[model samples]
Target: MVKVATFFAMSVGAFAFWQTMDKIHVWIALHQDEKQERMEKEAEIRRMRAELIRENKKRESLA
Candidate 1:
């Protein structure tokens, strides 16, 4: 009987541990995706700023 109880307890604990780990994994994945998206947005902004500066320089040279 004690052996059966021990087995049951271990199974429950293992299930709980894996469930928590799965949630952690999902959170990490979402965090990474968000970070990637933020980086892409920053790159786009930098590109736009560079283009604007180039346009301004061309205008100044023409003047």
Candidate 2:
């Protein structure tokens, strides 16, 4: 009887631990995706700024 009760308790604990790990994995994946998207947006902004600077310099030289 004692063994059976101990087994049940361990099973429950293992299940709870598995669920917690799954949630953590999903959270990490979501944050990583968001960070990648942010990095891409920042790169695009930098590119646009560089292009604008180049164009302004060209115009100033022509004037």
Candidate 3:
């Protein structure tokens, strides 16, 4: 049927468009990006604390 062919073509085109854009991936990819960012931030906080402790120790030794 012609209608079925048209529908299929439209769906395929929509899917291709979605794949190319940086928006609206149906909440799947967004969640993953947010989770990864959270992990990196936590790691950065830990590294900063370690650096601060080392600096304090150095300052204490010099006093």
Candidate 4:
């Protein structure tokens, strides 16, 4: 009886651990995707700002 109870408890614990790990992996993946998107947006903004500065300099030189 004790052996059966112990086995059952261990089984439950292992299952819980597996589920928790799965959720953590999913969260990490989502976080990484968000980070990548943010980086891309920032790069685009920087490029736009650089272009605007170049255009303003051209206009000033012409004037």
Q: Considering every candidate listed, which one attains the maximal TM-score?
A: 1
For candidate 2, write residues 1-63 as lDDT tens digits: 999999999999999999999999999999999999999999999999999999999999999
RMSD of candidate 4 to the true fold?
0.8
> What residue runs in model 2 are displaced by over 4 Å at the alpha carbon?
none
Across 1-63, the per-residue lDDT of candidate 4 in tens digits comes to: 999999999999999999999999999999999999999999999999999999999999999
Candidate 3 — which residues are off by over 4 angstroms? 1-25
TM-score ranking, high to low? 1, 2, 4, 3
Question: How accurate locally is residue 15 in candidate 1, as Cα lDDT from 0 to 100?
Answer: 100
Q: Which scores greater on lDDT, model 3 or model 4?
A: 4
Whichever of 1 and 3 has more lDDT, that candidate is 1
lDDT of each: 1.00, 1.00, 0.92, 1.00
**TM-score of structure candidate 4:** 0.93
Superposed by TM-score, candidate 3 places the C-alpha of residue 52 at a distance from the truth, in angstroms, of 0.6
Please write out the lDDT profile of model 1 over residues 1-63, one tens digit for every residue. Answer: 999999999999999999999999999999999999999999999999999999999999999
> 1-63, model 3: which lDDT tens digit per residue?
999999999999999897867465657698999999999999999999999999999999999
Model 4 stretches with alpha carbons more than 4 Å out: none
Which residue pairs collide in model 3, if any?
Answer: none
Residue 4 of model 3 has an lDDT of 100
Question: Clashing residue pairs in candidate 4, if any?
Answer: none
